[model samples]
Target chain A: MHADYLWTAAPLIVSAPMAKVAMPKLAAAVSKAGGLGFIAAGYHSDHLEDLLQEAEDLLQEGTAETPIKVEEGTPKFLPVGVGFITWSASLEKALPSFSRYCPAAVWLFAPPQGFRDLIPWATRIREATACRTKIWVQVGSVSDAVEVVEAIDPDVIVVQGLDAGGHSLARGASIISLVPEIKDKLQELRPFPQKQIDVFAAGGISDSRGVAAAVALGAHGCVLGTRFLASPESLVAHGYQKALLDASDGGTSTVRTKIYDKVRDIHGWPEGYDGRGLINRTFIDHLNGLSEVKNREMYREELKRGDEGYGVNGRLTTYAGTGVGLIREVIPAGDIVKSLREGARALLYGPHNVSKL
Target chain B: MHADYLWTAAPLIVSAPMAKVAMPKLAAAVSKAGGLGFIAAGYHSDHLEDLLQEAEDLLQEGTAETPIKVEEGTPKFLPVGVGFITWSASLEKALPSFSRYCPAAVWLFAPPQGFRDLIPWATRIREATACRTKIWVQVGSVSDAVEVVEAIDPDVIVVQGLDAGGHSLARGASIISLVPEIKDKLQELRPFPQKQIDVFAAGGISDSRGVAAAVALGAHGCVLGTRFLASPESLVAHGYQKALLDASDGGTSTVRTKIYDKVRDIHGWPEGYDGRGLINRTFIDHLNGLSEVKNREMYREELKRGDEGYGVNGRLTTYAGTGVGLIREVIPAGDIVKSLREGARALLYGPHNVSKL
Candidate 1:
């Protein structure tokens, strides 16, 4: 089953399924460029069918220009994947979509009931797709990875770090430490001769350097979220895109907080999970003891400003990772994938590399 | 001056100058194993001579077994370096040590007055060593890196991230993002045809995978602190070593706080700086609203426990990075260096590697 989705690229690059931002175009573009991409199903399955259909249309159109090569004996499915916020997403509604258009994979994240909650979702997805769609579980801690692997035996484990954008574990190690430790624990729990479980690193990765670093850290590939926010294919507002570009020193310019969700009235994120975004008036005002009612009212007013609503003083949320500083310009999603692949390969194997002695 | 300290090792591994923990034996062992090492001068320059002399004796004794190869056209100096907390270190007291030992490098960190405070320190050290001792400044943010480069034009910049142990910025990005952004900014600020400034990554790096990842992230090498704690040569107590070994899920088990310093009666760490260590009763009590006076008294009591004072329930400060979970056992510092080097090289260029397709 894993062999069916084995990417031909030397270092697999994945574009994260950012809620509402990663749409059909971005997902198809990444897949066209030999990288796996995911369309976010978000917290609901209401629009999943439309999103999948749109992605299928784009991929079909691109097939004439640059088709993703499928290996022999591999079952037919959409090359792109879909992502779900497992806690709120309706498994019943999603199973029909899976049966209708089988995505290559389904990424599960932040289950309120823990890894066990994912077992039923995984079983249903596999049953719906006749085992065509692989299960990918996102874990921020070694314990979570161990439980996920034990409970559902996910085909791929995405090891996310504290430096990631959007939603993530409120407390987590950076990939520099987390990936190897998780790898070691998994090896101990499920020794060799078992089914292979590919590990993909996500968080704080923006360019080829990060991809190469993830590979060196024992990850089979990397999943980038903040980097794709700069892609024209991404379904982000101009204000949000501008905010991402204007941001620097992401470690200082951005912060992880539940305030954004609270202002937007987005609840049920599960304990120990929060979102990282560019610091703005909303957060500053919240920190300064602004009443919740007033802050929410101000946030709604800022939304009315549209493109002008996202900046240092803007109240609109601009979700990004610590790697936001590294993103300088907007590029095509396909181009981003291609450049990352080439750059990572060069750093890893090139003779005239600065990393070499 | 920079060329004088050019190491022959690929992906140069470095043992951090963890105050008290990184001693003469540990520094010399790492230097003997083809990696640069640094002895901590701590907040004061007192006892500098003893540490340097001990390191000199150890290196001299080990020269028969393995000598650090020096290339032609480079002036000779002690292969080991010295680190200082610039805010509290007395330059008047350190000059004589530099002149006498002629250490290869001086790592400057935590200057209260800002990057300018390091200029005089760098100038005097170069003059004392006749330009043999290169200056290495540690920066946690891109803005700090820019300021340091403009202020002193350091020979090397140690880019530290939030995941680092010991003292670091209260807020900072992970090396996954910070390193590449700093590299890009440095390139822009100091374009081609300028003296080269090597960048070494310090934070959350424990093994060869981390070393390789740092290299991939555009770093010349890595500085490991927590990984060295398990080394027998390290000046750590038995219980502290046991605590490090027992701790898993470092991202959750460890935290960055100034409470440790406060309890130890240590002060004058620059603003926006704090130390990371294993979480214990001291922190829990402090978080639970224990008065500072009472917390201090309890901390002193825990210290009397000696080798039994460093665990989840113990109050002794066990300074360690998020990589603490990755360190499993005590290995000789030299063996750690060799293993890290060999492992990184294999991962970077090996044919049958998991990172490569």
Candidate 2:
């Protein structure tokens, strides 16, 4: 019974969208591999509609072998989800996708501060769509978690700790402490007015023990980023993959800043909210002359390189979480998922007990 | 050539020394299995001689196989090495086995600020025995590394990075940067070198990619502490092994302090040099109040409860490196070594060819 429900196969992994890395084909391959695939709705051109169509088309083609069967009485199908940078979703044209494609879930990042107003809009979407639309708000601190639980009442609360890659909502707490605290707090305050929210832990959840730890810490599952960043299906350049593999505990250090966002012309990120990323040669030079190169033009040269696809050379930071330290290889995302599941199971069940079971 | 040099059907691995947890028979079994077996040096006692004799006796009675030979031309001997806390090595009385056993290498840690004089004496003993004595210094920064290289000029330089388990030299620098810098510095200053120094990088080197990455960055090999700390042969409590297996990325937090040293009453660690270890409940409650109860008498009370002995009390502070984040299993060290070697070779020989070898 467990075998049927529990995924345990060669391709049990999913590839998540990263900035500029997650493209249509990557999502399609993950879905094709029998795992939930997601399209990152954060950084992209104005042709988001075309991009969504492309991803939907790929997901359809990828899942052609085993079409998702919606039982006659069931609501809708489940195969793919769309994750939006919560801060980015509020932009002028971000709502176009809501009017167009019926995505599985709208995974939100760094839940906005003004949650009192966004509640009705979120409810409206859930009520209107047959799709299991969830408000996947990313958070770091226990307080932020508490705020989201009370205000947004998200369908799924992604406890993205400091270990997670990309932008984070963690005020300062690390995932290690934040996970168990949130889990315990949720458990203690359960069966009350608060909805039964399924918690997922992200940030540096690269493998199975990580998955198991999250489960132990009160998370249903895990969300991996850097681990998937190196997948063959990921649109990340070969150089980026090599850099990820090459990094170790001290190989890369991340600093949260709005320096790149301003240069890349990406706006609307909330104050006190910044992304963590690698510091390359350009960053070093800029840091050396921070006072001298205070002007936007000086930073423009660095920013242009990233926009043009220079890969690691330009100031385009390899926005990664602290978990970047854990990534050593870029294997197929499917293999990673298999390892995570098996490893988690093995960790939960003693090796002796596991074999006996 | 590599295949022949490597053993296919042996179960040799390192033994953990969890006070009373490690038995002589386990050490014998590891040596009998065809791997390097280490007996942890006394942290609070001077019974190492008795332990060594017991291990030798056990090997003789445990098997019918021929006594293990480390390398050809060496006297019929056991492949046993002694591991010491660098801070403790300063107490000459604690290192009585130095003259009696003639250990292959004396792994040094947090050497006194000006302990360069001690290296010659330590080196002379190994030179007299012609045991190919290595001075494995634990370091975190490039400056610390340079000091170690300039001072000891030992046979092998073991660079214990942030990822390794146990007490590491606390320099804010990461292993990734340190390893490359050490390699480059070594290359840059070649003629002064007595021999081409071999640098082995440690910490978070849990798998092949880690080993391959270290070797690529100019490390001859790698060292693993946490991965070995949980093996069946280790003296660690079963619960500790479970904790290690259940850990994930950022699963355990590492802090450098004299809290454990003060509590264990194990002296000799110089000021400014602290050990990195697990931060548990005891640390959280009493870490700030250490000054009030920093007495040997109170430590005795904690030791009487014997929390450190059983590794149950969070205050006992388990010396594990940040690599605890990656260790998900307690398999034999030999199996780990084999996997690392094979996996590294696979990647090195794999089509991508990111590795320098």
Candidate 3:
């Protein structure tokens, strides 16, 4: 596994920073499976201290119960990171927690107008935690990458594609071209020591082939959200799992709408960055004039009526990436990690034989 | 082209039954560019005589106008076919055109329960026309293919994937496996000439690599519809063309809802089959409870408000398959055909060395 990680290997599989869904158990399982895990700091500033203590406690519990067994004397506690939507954490209130935890990696999603304001602050934490808690930023477009890389100069950058099950920040280009373009941009940046920056590509990375393709495209790792959503450890509803299995081919059927964000009363996201979800009944009726429902009390009541628990009605907006089509069943996060690794190995080193679909 | 069609080629190009869009000019453009083109027969039993007469007239016109000189006896007019959505054109309604046209090929979309009814009817047409026209059925699922192939015994079978834009009659197994499975099933059908049974794959086939992959997987040819929807000759409105161009990297931010269908009053579609259209302000509002809107009288007023000129809104349903994502810009039908054919040839016969993407 270590050899595969260094050279001639698939990416280091990392779970996505899915809000509410990225629980401690899911994170622990990812770390246990030799993959990176993230605890999303979504609207968590109010409870940051307790959240960090809980996450740290879980990591310690996992390490104590099942020590990393790669070799007899080698260290056990694998790396675990924490992520936050950039603008959300930029709030004056969230700054204390952001400074306190100094996570293995502080991942930023949906960055603000400038990374400069955030980078210097994050650098203080990096210096405090000699453990090299690197700073990573998520970007959707080539220009986004160039902008962030030039400003913040994060240790790692995550390139998210449209295929990802969740909200994609991609406004221009695609994951196909974005990866190479980012690599070229990094080469052009040409910082001291020819900075060894890592680019992690996220979204629609389900099986080994997807992971292999990402690595082949110059991504050091793959960040998977819906892939983990199908894991047994996930907090996702049972009906959602059934929907994932029933889905055929690449699970690419998704609609990015701001309805849920508006309905749930969750704000702070900029325009053009909507969420991708299944078209349920509530969504159907109000899709045309959301402003009508948003403004009118009566229409809002009608939407409330359809909010039955997951699968009972179409109103429950199950957030999934395009990769949901490829997931046929729910399994342990660790099992998925093993399968992804093994699948890539077989594709790379296995005999040149065609397998029947 | 004929030699490759018989031996080395795969069926990746799909001729759009554009109804009015499939004029002789459009058909000739695709055919002369070395791709298959089909004439559409939609609610045209009354016009079949004129339609066939016009088609022949156009073929002669194309032959006389073709710039490149051929060998002494090469057929000037390339192979052209006619297609009908089977369920839409009931047997009694469409048979007159089949007899009148005696096309080189006859294509049917949507399988009926009594598929056996098609075999003898098709055979009668073949017998009368000296077996020149081949019977081809468009199906969605492997099971649908099995049922139809077992009952009708068509000469060619088209496996339409979920990626196909517009109304799909088939369900179950995706186009990826569906193509190979149909080929295998046809081979197993006793008393049939297996080599003569060509299986073509359709849906989400917009580029050269897709065509090459389909051929490599044993498909006789590919079917393209969404790709052609953007062609200059298509009757679709300018707004529709702009929308198609906006759908880049095959990334379609669309929701498959019945809002437009209900507003337009086009009924009799199966429950599972929904249409994919651009996710705009209008679609999001009406997707959920259009059933209520359907029950109410005076709903036509709201529908009228949504309509723009030339099928932009409620008037047209923006019929497309998943291939809409691959389309970047609107070009001529001739250019699309020529590029696809030449692109496939290059990939098939390109240089020995290749780099991983």
Better of 1 and 3 by lDDT: 1
- Order by TM-score, highest first: 1, 3, 2
**Can you list each candidate's DockQ?**
0.70, 0.05, 0.06
TM-score of chain A of 1: 0.96
Docking class of 3: incorrect
In model 2, which regions exceed 4 Å deviation? A1-17, A43-49, A62-78, A91-100, A114-121, A169-177, A191-196, A207-218, A237-239, A245-268, A292-299, A302-314, A322-357, B1-357
Better of 2 and 3 by lDDT: 3
Q: For residue B204, what is the lDDT in candidate 2?
A: 55
For each candidate, what TM-score against the reference? 0.96, 0.53, 0.60
lDDT of 2 by residue, B153-252 (tens): 6555666554444555433333444565556556666756656666766655555545554544446656666666666766766656755665443323
Interface Cα RMSD for all candidates?
1.5, 12.7, 7.8
Candidate 2 chain B worst ten-residue window by lDDT = B1-10
What TM value does the first chain of each candidate achieve? 0.96, 0.79, 0.83
Fnat for each predicted structure, in order: 0.78, 0.03, 0.00
